[model samples]
Target: MDFNPPPYQGTNRILGGKSVTMQDVAEAAGVSISTVSRVLDERLPPSRSKAAERVRKVAQELGYRRDIMASSLRRGGTGTIGVLVPRLSDMVMALVYEAVFRAAERHGYFAIVATSGDDPAQEQSAAESLLDRRVDGLILATSRLDDQLPAQLRQRQIPHSLILRTDGVSRSALGNDEQGGYLATRHLIDLGHRDIGLLAGPNFTSSARDRQRGYRRAMNEAGIPVREEWVCESGYGIEAGESVGYSLLTRENRPSAVFAINDDLAIGVMAAAHRVGLQLGQELSLVGYNDIPLVARLPIPLTSVHVPFDHVAALAVELLLAPTEPSDPIRRVMPTLIPRASSTPPASS
Candidate 1:
């Protein structure tokens, strides 16, 4: 039997049946290990030097691949960001995650996400799992007004940033919910609707509470008394919206306009209005928050508050990677109001 090996053909050729390393490529290309590392780093700008070209060629011939884990460890980071969301099934949550993903990529980091279902225990478990994987930092989207997770992370000296909501102590990036709420309600007021009902989401979240405050401020500014019964406490879901919407519409003193803090709730309210034979734009003015894409395509397009999720995501990543704690712990992005067919001046106007 002839004992001869074939020439290397630019494939993953193991030497002594061991994986190829940067040292092997450096030796073959007549360069230092540091040079090989710098040239192979995808985060850096590619070099056009002759040695770089030779190093590339030698690396290909030796079938050498960079070990991202070892590289990141040496650089004191994992090159990954872990993101925690309430649930990916919710459109707003999904959108926020997508924005974070893009922002992470722009900062030369990869993002991994896990759902917590808005449960405290689940959120704690999921965050631990991400930390166990050695992610460099975390971005949380399931923060609540009374959440203790942020405090725990701070005490442990973990690098983390909160998004969408906050506990008010940690680094956070979110839309100005109060301003968004005011814009939505004030739009209805400008349409000559005095009796404007509100579909307020649960009070566990800072967003819901701030939005409710904005609603009260708007109503008070217009010299209108906010009917305690008209401000229905509901969940951030379509079903909850429908239930509250039905009750409000059935009452003899129903409002001419309504503002739902969430787009899902607004959609549900629309269904309830249709069920009661009410004409959407003519009889009931509705405004929703988040300006989800589905609302724009409805028969009567929804008026909504458009949140700049991308801006918030970028700010969250910046806060997470800041060299020192920023003086401003919480960053709030402004939102714009989008008018559509669903809101119009009352017939009496």
Candidate 2:
């Protein structure tokens, strides 16, 4: 018996119950397979040439979906990006991961995430597990000030980009944290708040440290003395905020306004104020960062610094996939301050 494949039917072979392949599209469009591949690749910029247009039209009509998994294997890649975060419980981290996922999809890549619990050992372990799965690259939002993972990944010739926080030596994409901090603090100052308190996040991360710097800069520029007792180092959580906030609020000369480095912290402070019988936006104004969705829906809407997570995610993926090292290793997207009812002139003013 002869063992030969059937002749190529026309590109409109959907009726045959067979998956439309790139070869079929190429044949239908009267183009080479290579041309079809390039035209259909979402990772590359779309082409406006007549041949490219014809290929796309044919692919669409034929219902040809690129087999990402098979193509990735052919190209010696997994076509997947691994994302590392402290934890998804944090709204900010969840937002960043979601943004990264969407950005990866736009680039024809898949993304997976793992939590490190903000521990260095666990961070390395999670990274290694992802790498073992043969992911094409990594996007880490868990980097600490003295993180060794970035350096280790570099030495191993791995492609990765840091997000949210950085060690200063790696390729990074994040918001201008210092500017965000300054904006949050300056808004309170402009609202006639002189005795301002700070719910500063942990000092281990660059984001927290930079934001504190911005806070200091704003205070110094306004000729306001920053009292040592007013700046409290805390975790990036509501519980931490509440604990530190209670301490700050119960002081003899408590601040009338508080700037929490993140929305969670701000919410925590709000809770603390409630327990102490302080009315927000009147007796005790509050500001937060990363303007997560929940803040706007509160009883007294929170004023927060809105970080553009999508922009940061896109930049991170681009930086990770870049063939050559970028001259500017660190990229910072500017944040916007969204004022709400939570921030207002102090009752005394």
Candidate 3:
């Protein structure tokens, strides 16, 4: 009766004494600090339930809290994944980044994202920054096919996954770019449009090259001449599409059908056609790729190709985590053509 729990003489009653710590609790509990931590974190063995609960209660009475950062350092892993993208503002990149984040979080890894603005030098700099932070892995969509990043990454021993565009060094993923192009272009041809124009992206990118090739192949198979003047090369954004659209529409002989590399270009081209007093889907048939979410809700719905960002992104992250030896390099997601209000048969049809 005189020994009533030692009168609660613990030095950490106010939680600022730094008196009793995880170590003290581990000693009293007859276990390692890691075991105590796991028990407190609800990650320990089921058989230790009663004892774990007692340990947690004692730790609380001891005013003990685990230092997660210090524990991670002890394990030599930051439990973080570095993510690099050219630009998150772009719809495709935005979708891919969000997917990467969800996947990373599933595997108990936090994602640290950075943007390189599509510059090679800047991409390298961003990668270096991520490495300096001691990320366990990286997921990158900023490298070009022939860029030195792949080689450099190997030299630096960075376990990474390539997304969208590849530097050809490791497991990677991509949408059905050529198929998307062919689908968009073939839809126009099937609508009785023989005189078709292609709004191509910058020549430096694999996307622009592949999409343009698919367009040309579609026309060639249909025996329609792919006119040099009708194929306009420009940057792959709204502004680039707008400028080229104006030029193509005002030409001596305008195309009856137009195919843009992506949705933004298609939107811009539609604006151009309207400014010139032409009705879309009637006076001029138009199509585009990368069926962005907003395309369906537009004033005039766009006929476009849909790229599955979810599947592609998941595969990319899986590759980074697994890194199978001689991993199958041919992984690719399919694309679908969405026919909307933006295209119609030529007048002759």
Candidate 4:
């Protein structure tokens, strides 16, 4: 007899042997379907060694493969997660996405990335689109916590979690913003600069606002009054920092020390100061946050706060994946300050 070529296996297509199902594997292993599933997913704890071994043996014999898509579909899911972040261009946000993607993959789910361009309206639209596509859960870095988007997600009973940030009047796991602020400020202050200036970020973002608050807290604690005129407000880009940094430095007898909300803004401030022939860490001491990849490499090294993205990202994923009620979303992580070459005591103090 001639041997036939291996046939494709699907609903209609026939292979030489019968297709293996969960029930078939369970019967072969002498266990329940759920046991087979648990074994296949390795979901059972180490205590269930004998049970796992039996299921693994049967699966190996039958070449049983659990079709994740079919499983998710049967359970009314797409096994896909929606991730909404501010912008992929932001290094910090990108790191968060990478971690979330890896976490989702391990759980047999696909991740879809969306950007809201820092607009509430854009975030809503992105969320709606994700929902329409039937994602199993959502990981959002764009959440304002108490914003309408969170409210809407709650009303719909959607599975969503915040990463990099949490909704609250107070800062959460993403950082010890107050402490970071204090460290940055105290670093400048300790360097003998009393009249420090804060080149702030977009006031609308809670993260940005917190840094400003942190600056104030440190100064207040030090008994040094914050020069209100020295604090310059700006938005989220290099240009924002440049304009704010330049304007702040040039407009008044300028602050001898400057603290920026993030590394990008700090870099901008550095560039602007360079244009005016002011040496960093000499005449002016500068501090920044989000010690990104370029911090150490910059022409003038950066003194900034390091928010551990890996820890925060993993925590966010763990929280999202946990089978828990809506009791309370926990605040999980915090940022640390890293002093670099760019900061020093001002000449006049």
Top candidate on lDDT is 2
| Per-residue alpha-carbon lDDT of candidate 2 for residues 32-56, written as tens digits (9 for 90 to 100) | 7778877777767899999998988
Per residue, candidate 4 scores C-alpha lDDT tens digits across 121-229 of 9999999899899888788888663467876776777877777666762222366566677778888878788878898787766677778888999899889998898
Model 3 lDDT tens row, 199-288: 997776667788888898899999998899999998767888889999999988999889999888888898899889988988998898
Winner by lDDT between candidate 2 and candidate 1: 2
Candidate 3 clashing pairs, residues 3+ apart or interchain? none
Predicted candidate 4, C-alpha RMSD: 7.1
Candidates 3 and 4 compared by TM-score, better number:
4
70: Cα error in model 1, Å = 4.0
**TM-score of every candidate:** 0.83, 0.91, 0.79, 0.81
lDDT of each: 0.89, 0.91, 0.79, 0.76
Model 2 regions more than 4 Å off: 1-15, 26-35, 48-62
In candidate 3, stretches whose alpha carbon ends up further than 4 angstroms from where it belongs are 1-76
Can you tell me which runs of candidate 1 are displaced by over 4 Å? 1-67
lDDT for position 338 in model 3: 92
The TM-score of candidate 2 is 0.91
